[model samples]
Target: MKAKLTDAFVKNITPPASGRLDIVDETTPGLVLRVMASGVKSWSIRYRPKGRKQLRESYGTYPSTSLSDARARAKALTAAASVGRDLVSEEAAAAAAKAEEEAKAKTIADVVADYIKAHVAKTRKAGVTEKLFANHIVPVLGKKTVGELRRADVVELLDSLKNKGWRTNAQVNRVHAALKACLNWAVEREYLDANPAAVVKKQVTERPRDRVLSDGELKAIWEATDVRTDPSRAFIRLLILTGARRDEIRCMTWSEIDLEKGIWTLPKARNKGHRDHVVPLSNEVKAILEALPRLGECVITTDGKIPYAGQKSLKESLDKAVGASNWEHWTLHDFRRTVTTGMSALGVREEHRERALNHAVGGIGNKVYDRHAYLDEKRAALQAWADRVMLIVDTSGPQNVVAFEAS
Candidate 1:
C-alpha cells in the first residue's frame, strides 16, 4: 500500500485491471503516483484542507515530474494546507497576475505605432518624422518595454548615431526630441509613470547660425541658376527673392498661389509656424510662377503632380557653382538667412522682416490679436529684396557665372 516511489518502480509497475492503481510514498507522506489502466502515470498530493474535504492537486506527470520534485512540491502544498491556506486559489491568483502583467507590458514599437497614429501622423512633417524614428530609434529599442527604458538606454541609442557619424549633433537632438515626445505622450495617456528622456540632456549644443552670404556670393548664386532647369532654377531664385522656407516653396500647390494678386498664401498645414502665411511675390518671382507649366497640383515638380525631391542633386550642382566662386560654406537654408540678413541691411523694419520670413513675433497678444496681414509692407519688402538681388546678380563678373550640369 505504501512505498518509496522510484524511477525503476514506476517503469516496472503493472497496469490495473479496471480503473486505476494508487501507490503512496511512505518516505514522503501524501505524495502519490496514480497509474491509470492505460499505463499513464501522474504525481499528485492529497491533502485535507481545514474544515473542508480532502483535495487532490496534480503536480505533473510521472518520470517527467520526477519523484523528488513531486515530493518537494507536495511538501510545500501540505505546509500551506496545514496553515489553512487554499493552495489552489493562491496558485490561480498568481497565474492570473502573471498573465495580466504580460498583457499590459507594451514594447516601444507598439507605443510608437499608437503615437504616430494619434499625434505625429496628423502633423505636416509626419513622413519625415516617421522616417527619423524608423532609421534611428526603432531598430535598437523597439522591442524594449517603456517602463524598462532608462536614461542610459537612450544615451546609448543617441551615441550610436554619433559614433557612426550617422547623424550630426543637431540631428541627434532632433531624434532625442522625437523620442521624448513619444514618451511624454505615453505618460499623458497613463501608459507610463514618467519619461526617461525628461532628465537626459540633449547631446548637442545648438548655436545661432550667422553664415550670411555677401552680395558678391549672392550674385554668384543668382547667376549660377541660369544653368539649371525650370523647377530648380525657379526654386533657387524664389528662395532668394521670396525668403520662404525650402519646403514651403517645394511643396507649393497651384491653389496656394494667386498670380493675379501676386501672392503665395501658405495654409497652416504647409507652414512651419502653423498659421496662414501670405508671401507677397515680387514681379520676378511672379514671372517664374507664370512660366511654370501646370503639370500637376504642385508648382516645383518635374512631373507636375508630386513635389520636387531632387534636393541632393540640386545641392551638388549648387556647390559646384558656388565652389567656382571660392565662396564660403553655405546651405539652402542659408538663403533664408541671406534674405533675412539682406532685408535688415536694406533697412526693412524688424516686424515686417520677421513677418516676411513667416516668423511668429511677440507674445500671445500679437499672435492672437494682431489681425493685420501687412500686405502692403510685405509687398514692398519683397519688391525691395528682389530689386537688390537683381542688382547684385547683374554686377557678378563674367567668370563668376557658370552653368549647372543637367541631371
Candidate 2:
C-alpha cells in the first residue's frame, strides 16, 4: 500500500545525475530511494548521519547489483541497528576515523622518510647513501609497511639475493639500520612497539681488497690519462690528488674550489658525513684544478649540467688501463683504500684518517655517547695525505709505499 515494500516493486523515479543509480532495502521503515530527476537509478539505503536528521547512503547502481543481495544487506544492517548497534553510518564512520589515526602512528617507510628529511643536507652531498637506497633500498622495500615487517622478511629478502648474498647482506644491513633509526625515532615519539631491526643479527663476511697502484702503474695511468683529449683526463688527475669520493669529485663546480684559499668547500648537501666538509688543496691538486674548464656552470660539463653518467667513462678507461697493467681483481674503490693505506704509512692517526675519508664509523665507544665528527683536523690530514700521494706518484720506484694494514 505505502509504495509496495517487496523486492519485485517497480522503480518510480530517476536520479538527476548522469551516472547510474539503484534502489535497495534496509531494516529501516519509510527510508526508500526517491531517485532523482536524472535517467539513472542508484540503490541507496536511508539512514541517519551523526547529529543529522536523515540522509540517503548510496550503496551501488542497479543491473550491476542483484535484488537478493540488496535484501540480504538490508537485513544485516537492520539486525545490527535492532541490537542497539548504532547504524553503519555513524559506527563505521567512527571506526574508519580511528583506523586512519592509527595509520598515522608511523610505519618503517614513514620513519625512513623522516630520517631522510632530517638529513637532507648530508644525503645531498654524499650521494652514496641516497644512491644505495634509490638503486636498491626503495626498489626492494619502499612499499612495505614498516610496522608489518618482521625479522623473517629481512632474512628472506637477503636470501633471495642468491649469488649476490654478500653484497645483499651489506646493503640489506644498511637498509636495516635505516629502518632501525626510523623505529627508534617512532619510539621517541611514542609511536612504535619497538625497533624490529634491533633483534635482527646480520651475517658478517670479510672482503679483503688489495688495489694500490705501483710506481710504474701510476705513471702509465698518468701518462695515458694526460694524453687523452677529454677534460676528464685532468679531472682524473684531480681525483688521484684529492682522494675524495667519486660523487664528491664528480659533482664539483667552479664555485666550490678556491685556489687562493687552498680550499674547496663541499656543501652540506653532498657530504656523506652530514657535515660541511672542507678540503685543503695540495700542489698537485692545484695543477689539476687549474687545468679544468671554468666555463658554463659545472667544472666538467659543456652544457653546464652535472653528468647524468657519474663516472662510467672514467671507470671504463680505468678498467682498460688495469687490463693493460695485467692487474686483476682490483677496482676503483681500491684507490680510496690506497689513500687510507698510504696515509697510515705516512703517520696519520686513526681518527684523523677516518675523518679525511669522511667515513661514518661506529664502535663500542661512539654508541656510549654522541660525538660530533672530527671535521677540522680531518681537513688538514686529508691535505697532508694528498701531498704524500703526490710525492709517492712522483717517486714511484720499487717499494710499495701505499701500504695499509687492514682491519
- lDDT leader: 1
**How do the residues 102-211 of candidate 1 rate in per-residue lDDT, one tens digit apiece?**
53488899989999999999999998899988988999999998768888999999888878775247888899999999999988876677898888898989987788
1-407: candidate 2 lDDT, tens digit per residue: 13434444534443455544334333434244444456544455554433445544556655465545555655565555555554666767998777655755455456566666676335453355556556655666667665576777666655554347452245556655655655576666544556666786764453566668665666566666755754567656766666777667767877888899777888777766766777777666777767666666577554567642436676678668656556654555656777777677767777778766767557867645647645566655666666565555566554433333432
| TM-score attained by model 1 | 0.70
Candidate models: Cα lDDT each: 0.84, 0.61
Off by over 4 Å in 1: 1-104, 324-328, 363-365, 396-407
- Cα lDDT, model 2, residue 285: 77
User: Candidate 2: global Cα-lDDT?
Assistant: 0.61
Q: What is the Å distance of residue 206 in model 2 from its true position?
A: 4.4
Q: For candidate 2, what's the RMSD?
A: 12.2
Error of 1 at 7 (Å): 59
> What TM-score does model 2 achieve against the real structure?
0.55
